[model samples]
Target: MRLPKLLLFIVLFCFVFLSGAQIQAQETNEKADAKQAEPPSSVKELKPVTTIDPLVPLDQLRIMVRPLTKDELQVEANAWFELLRNKSRQIAAARLGVKKTNEAIATNDDQQALDSLKKAESVQHMADEKARQTEEELTKQAQETLGVDVAVDAARPDPAKAEEGTTASTEEKSATTADSTSTPDNPTTTQSAEAMKAAFLQNINRLQDERTALSDRLEVVLTSLAAKGGDVETYRKYIAAVSGLELDTSDASAAWSGIKGWFVSKEGGQRMGWNLGKFLLILFLTWVVARIGSTVISWLLERKVRLTQLAENLISGTIRNVIYLVGFAVALTALEVDMTPVLAAIGATGLVVGLALQGTLSNFASGLMILINRPFDVGDVVTAGGVTGTVKQMNLVSTNFRTFDNQTIHVPNNSIWNGVITNITANKVRRVDLEFCIGYSDDFEQAEQIIRDVLADQELVLREPEAVVVTHALADSSVNIVCRPWAKTTDWWAVKTAVTREVKRRFDQAGISIPFPQQDIHVYSTDASKGNGKIETVSK
Candidate 1:
């Protein structure tokens, strides 16, 4: 009886505990629902945060939200406009931050300056990104709402337009509303859309200009901070970050924008112009110095050295070209152009050209050898490369020759150098050989004497080397007398022709017969009628 009474008491205690726990759980759920249904106490709490002061932490920068659907765009257009205005404000704040950083740097507050600069750079980047997002959203909205493709006309959104649109009076809003509610055929809606496109383009231009100005100012501050011996690595990171955020435009617009920015930004345009002017001045000075150097070298070569014309020209021209090349490199350096890539490209091009022009290169090398060896000079009569002519001109690849019969020939230097070269006018004197045929019956001594007299009468012939007149050969019908006369190289042709004409006239007057070849033929005929044929000779 005691155990049954105890079990009933425990069961009652368990039921009361379970009921109490259930009532408490219901009360807690009811309170939670009531709290969930309560509204915020202030309207300002509903607005997105837009305070991007220089003192604000970078992580707390505002994150702009773009509406993704047509209904959402309609509901959120005003909010987006406010966000765009916030972005513009952020840009302005970044500008202010840069100015403050500059001041801090001036005060030698390195840490503070670096922190401020970093914050400004971060804000600028965020603002730039938000501006791009706003532009994209505007394009999307235009396409979704008005069925107008602004991208087809290369119309882009302007960040400034957001501020302007947000600040517009109520009357403008009412007018825009009236235009939007009009029928599709109404010209006012079309006009509104067109005006919006123009505004977008104009705003984009303004935004780009403002970004350029801010970027330029920031660059100046960074430069000043670096000059002050601040933390370089930190500022360098800022520089890299800022560089990445530069506004990008279409190719045509970008070019035009750059030109406009160049003129608009005093530091950039003036600095570049100064650099360009210095580059040109240095180049001009280099050219002057190079010219003077070449002239001096030419004078020294002409007065102090006896070199071939080709060698002289080659040396002077090479020196001049090297000077010009160095000057050009220096000019490029003045303009802050990097030369490593230029030199690498030049070396690569030289190698490729060398490979493609093997035969031409062989000629060039041969020409250098010829210049060094002093084989021949301009105006010297040469017999080389299977041709005999006077050297007219020469270059690294080929030599020009004017033939005795008035024909121009271009001979590769390789051909001339690889073969035996005969320079007729290399020496002051040359020998002319002449052969005359006479009858064997005539006195050889008289013929020899006549030839000697002709050589003696020629004023151009040289007497120191003496002339030679000898019987060279005994032919079938005559004797061949050889005449060798030495003369100045310049008079070689004149002496030879005069001596030949004089010898012929003397021979005719001296009755020394010049022989001609003659032949006699004999034929025998037999009479067919005679049984014992007697051979008879017939002469005609």
Candidate 2:
């Protein structure tokens, strides 16, 4: 009985001990697991204290073993012992002897400066490691965040649909507000909802602004095109041409097909055809009108006129230009163009061009004056603008003259209009002024009679003016005489030549001497009184 009781007590003791030991073991395991779940404090520990927050982020820990304070050294020794318990751990550690030597320096009792520098260096290293870890973690998080935002932006709704929806929402909101205002009981609720609606419709206001701007620009472009001769039919034809282009639509059939069909309609074709027909008609009418106008102008110019060739050319040019101008204006009107602005623009351009060509305008005006006044007709010999020549032709800018030497001269009309003009051929008869000189030793009366006889013999010499020869000047060797004779203007040169030749020949025959320039001189030599030198005599 004693043995059995002892055995039962032993079994109960073993069972109780085993159960307590198992419970203790389980508690220890749970504590180890808790520590393993946590992140490291100083990174020297074999396991961390809590699991890290992946989203919050943490960088990898860096550790450096070095000297510590005496108190911290004891803690480090204990920590090393603990590390030994987990000997399988691979971690950097300073030897105890080396740590003690370094810790003595760190305590700095006799070497305080060295110890302070060591402490500062350790602190700085720790701070730098922490900053690097934080920076790395932030970079990783920033990359992930950026990628997410990109995905979100790419998935955002299309702007066109958003604009349409926003517009509809605004209209609904306006209607709802009007309804709410009609019912007074829901005023507060309506105001709150209206504020929310206003916030939501901000994008709608912006879209509407853009749409208004686009519409205004479209109107401007349309007006410009129309003013410059673009029409609805032109637009329709352009659309038709673009639509007829063949496109491979396997990848995008629906969208392109709808676009193509919209432009290739029967209305578009008819519009283009009508425009083409109208263009051809306008062109034909223009040609016919131009031909008829030119013919009429030519006929008018061909009519009898007292004007010269140059004047006739000027008049005909002016008439043809006027006719073409009128025709152009009429054609533009027929084409349904608004000509008011066009005329205004043309007037402005003309004003600018006229100002720029002021000198040319003056020349043209002077040419016109020359044509109208008839100062000298063509084929008349005139002296004007320092030039003596026969008039050839007068153009808008210059007058042409053929000089006696067979040289052609272009004189500006401005000079001709503002200078003296001498028309030598204005009358049927002209004077032939002559001068003659005879020797003082000769008989003046005889020389006079000889000139009169010479003039009387010439057939083309005129007697109406009554040629008179008289003694005009007395000189050292000769007496000068003036001869005046009237002659037909056409035979002036011939008559003058004949009379001069005859008078000289008759004087020679009649013994009326015409002396050359003569001089007489007396000379006395100073040496003649002394009878030392002989005087030289000279004769010619």
Best by lDDT: 1
**Per-residue lDDT over 1-540 for candidate 2, one digit per residue giving the tens place of the 0 to 100 score:** 999999999999999999999999999999999999764565443321111211121121111112222233333223222222221111011111122223333342423322332343343234333433433343344345334322223564533344345434534544454454444354433342334323322332332233222222222333334444444344323323422223324324323533343344333334345655665666567667666765566566557555665576556666656666775666555544457678789888998999998887888999888888877877889998889999887778888899999999998888888899898987889888887777767789888888988888888888798888889889776788899888887888887888888887898898777776776544556775677755555432
1-540, model 1: which lDDT tens digit per residue?
Answer: 999999999999999999999999999999998977664354222322211111122233212122122222223333333333544555454334334434433443334433444454445445655655654554465355545544322254444454445224212532563545434334443343334323323333444444444443333333333444433355334434533223334334434544565555544566568879999998898889888988888888888997777677778877888888998899897775657568879888998888999999999999989998989988999999988999988888998999999999999999999999999899998899999999878999999998988888788999979888899899877899999999998999999899999999999999998888744455556677775555555423
Clashing pairs in 1: 158-204
What TM-score goes with each of the models?
0.52, 0.41
For each candidate, what is the lDDT? 0.63, 0.54
> What ranges in model 2 sit over 4 Å off?
1-348, 511-540
Show model 1 residue runs off by greater than 4 Å: 1-283, 302-306, 332-338, 348-353, 405-408, 441-443, 517-540
In angstroms, the error of model 2 at 260 is: 26
